[model samples]
Target: MNSIQMDSDPIAVLMQEHHRAAKQLSLLEQAVISINVDGFTRHAFECIAEAIRFFEGEFRQHDKKEEQFLFPLLEKHQPGITREYRNEHRELWSAFNHLLSCVNDVEDGRLRGSSRQELVETATRIVHLLRAHIANENTILFVKAKKLFSTEEYKEFRDNVASVTA
Candidate 1:
């Protein structure tokens, strides 16, 4: 679902990936909450693992495209705003690493009640942060990029995205 078709606009493709990431994060948040209420089970671990894998694979690629192509283009026009968004990306990455660590611990049979609680808390934070991040990028970043880039620049950016993502 994260795979974008060749004909689609690159910005639209990134937005679609964001939506998919949000859905996966919501699933992770719910799974963690369920584990907190009902205690950790194999199913919960599987869900968490799957979410982590999705992030590590597709989501990471999406992040790279933004960082490598989109952000730099935006930064040329809006350095302050781009810097703020890049900081947010760093924070999001830290949160993701925390969630990945928690999942690894669970897989290793270290699912204490406190650990489950931590997982739920971490996942909730990630879900909220990412939702906000996506909204900001969609509304502000992408909109500005669309308006600011010349036709040739936008085409080059889109082609770079396609090359990396393909």
Candidate 2:
């Protein structure tokens, strides 16, 4: 932990956003399992698309900044802990991207020729990965970042979150 006392580290705030994203992701995943997308159910597709877009729009920015700026700072402060966080972030992002790509294929009709099982698998994998990732960040990384960073740091992070939510 850096001796610096930031009001709230941006990482902690971003971690909170991840928790919210995880719940929404779960709803979309449930819809995927329960609904028939290959039947071209427009409403179901729209719901899933909206959720995916929400993640792409909100989560992407948070991750980018965390990976690019906040993460590096934390790594400098605590190499071992930051390494674990960074790895988890990368894995979660990869799974999310992979899952979203499958959804995009279905939306574009490319996945129409495939088994519905593929789509189901994609949804399951994404939901599982995101939930686990959020749990780890919320329980471990967020607390660490909050304790390690100072108030000014927290303010900056909050501003970033506000900009995205707005």
Which candidate number maximizes lDDT? 1
Q: Per-candidate TM vs. native?
A: 0.90, 0.73
Model 2 lDDT on a 0 to 1 scale:
0.68
Write down the lDDT of every candidate, Cα atoms only: 0.84, 0.68
lDDT (10s digit) by residue, model 2, range 1-166: 3444445545556766777787678777767866654554766667677777877787787777666666655565677776766777777667677767777777676755563666667677777777777777777777777676566665655566556545
Off by over 4 Å in 2: 1-12, 36-40, 111-114, 150-166
Question: What is the per-residue lDDT of model 1 for residues 37-153, given as tens digits with 9 covering 90 to 100?
Answer: 888777777788878889899998999999999888887876776887889889989999998888778778886768877888888888899899999999988989888877776
Alpha-carbon shift of residue 66 in model 1 (angstroms): 0.5
- Let me know the TM-score candidate 2 reaches against the reference structure: 0.73
TM-score of 1: 0.90
Global CA lDDT computed for model 1: 0.84
Which candidate should be chosen as best, given TM-score against the real structure? 1
